[model samples]
Target: MTGPVVRKCPLCGKPRSAEHAPFCSTRCKDRDLMRWLDDGYALPGPPALDEEEGKA
Candidate 1:
């Protein structure tokens, strides 16, 4: 019988480790970090106005 849905690693479909949490291994973890550093992820929203620029 199915008990519950087990959470899988987002980087790869593998069992998650206690240390890595969401990622399967350090490599996947590092890869995810690199993606963020390279602006691989972003949020959609209107651009915020610069308060200082408004004063000028």
Candidate 2:
């Protein structure tokens, strides 16, 4: 029989904790937050138009 599938933490590859869900601990969770706050993650999009260009 096969055992239940284990999910590893996205940050440290550690087993995920029920409390943290996707992360293994608060540290990893906080790190992921920091990455977001610091613009470490971004979505695909075209360049934004500048205010000057719109004014022209």
Q: Model 1 lDDT vs. the true structure?
A: 0.88
Q: Please, what is the whole-model Cα lDDT of each candidate in the order they appear?
A: 0.88, 0.97
Stretches of model 1 off by over 4 angstroms after superposition = 48-56
Q: Write the per-residue lDDT of candidate 2 for residues 1-56, one digit (tens) a residue.
A: 99999999999999999999899999999999999999999999998899989885
Candidate 2 lDDT score at position 2: 96
Taking the tens digit of each residue's C-alpha lDDT, what string does model 1 give over 1-56? 88867778898879788799888899989999999999999899988789987786
Most lDDT-accurate candidate: 2
TM-score of every candidate: 0.71, 0.86
- Cα-based lDDT at residue 41, candidate 2: 96
Using TM-score as the measure, the top candidate is 2
Candidate 1, residue 30: CA error in Å? 0.3
